[model samples]
Target: MTFVTKLSFASGDRDVLAETVQELKDTLERKGAECKGPHASSPETVSVPQYKRLRAGDEFSPWRYDVYKRSMEIHGADDIARDVVARDFPDSIHVEVEVDRKKPLGHRRD
Candidate 1:
């Protein structure tokens, strides 16, 4: 059996997001870990409505911002994936991790 760890990162700042992902890719490569990619996604705009008063009689313009996203997968490298996930990231960046267990070809559940 093998494990594939997927990491997803998102942030309002594109520069910081790119930098963080790049650094992680470099680290994984240096450690001889099999990495899939640091795939990037199109920026997404998010809007939030604001109310001037508690009663909401008057409302301000909707606050809008762009969010950037990047993702990568560490294949069959549990130690490297664990280290990367354990490290602290910037407050502005959001990280998500998912692990998938892969069985060898023709393998079946007993």
Candidate 2:
């Protein structure tokens, strides 16, 4: 069974928020889960190189308190959200997640 997971964050900064998101992604992957989706940032723009590093998992750094909101449509993921939630995020940041118990099938309901 699969489900749609919507992760949201309210932080003091964007840079650090991005880092936290990346770490969460890694953590999810490590726990045998897969995630995918586009991101919406308040800055209105994310550089190309920055995107590349994040995609390649090579741009993690210490950042200020920043809130991150990550919405993922995932598969075969259980307890992953709980574990990720347990991670220690920056004090200046807050993370939230909404998990929808519906698997995303390729077939559309026309």
Candidate 3:
């Protein structure tokens, strides 16, 4: 039996996101754990229209920004994965982790 630790990170600040991911990858690598990736997802554009006062005829350009995401899988490294999930990160960054246990697909014949 083995576990796959899926980690996802998101942030509006690209630099902060990259730094956080890199630090995690480095820690796992230093511990000699097998890591799959820091797979990047397309930036999602988020916009919110700004309205001036309560008037029904006034509106300003929408505030626009991109949110970046990165994902990675850690194979058979439970301890390392736990440490990563437990570690503290910047308040502006968001991190999520999921653990999935895997078993052999077929019955074994002795």
The model with the greatest lDDT is 1
lDDT order of candidates, best first?
Answer: 1, 3, 2
lDDT of 3 by residue, 9-106 (tens): 99999999998899889989999999988999999999988888786668898899999999999999788888888999999898888899887679
Worst 10 residues of 3 by lDDT: 101-110
TM-score against native, each model: 0.96, 0.57, 0.88
Residue 51 accuracy (lDDT) in model 3: 87
On TM-score, the stronger of 1 and 3 is: 1
The TM-score, computed over Cα atoms with residue i paired to residue i, of candidate 3 is 0.88
1-110, model 2: which lDDT tens digit per residue? 46666766665576777777777777677877877753665533323333235365665443433234544444556677666656688886666667777636785665
- The digit string of per-residue lDDT tens for model 1 on 22-104 reads 99999999999999889999999999989998886689999999999999999998988999999999999999999999999
Task: Give the whole-model CA lDDT for all candidates, comma-separated.
Answer: 0.94, 0.62, 0.90
Model 1 lDDT, residue 20, Cα? 91
lDDT of 2 at 103: 37
TM-score of 1: 0.96
Off by over 4 Å in 1: none
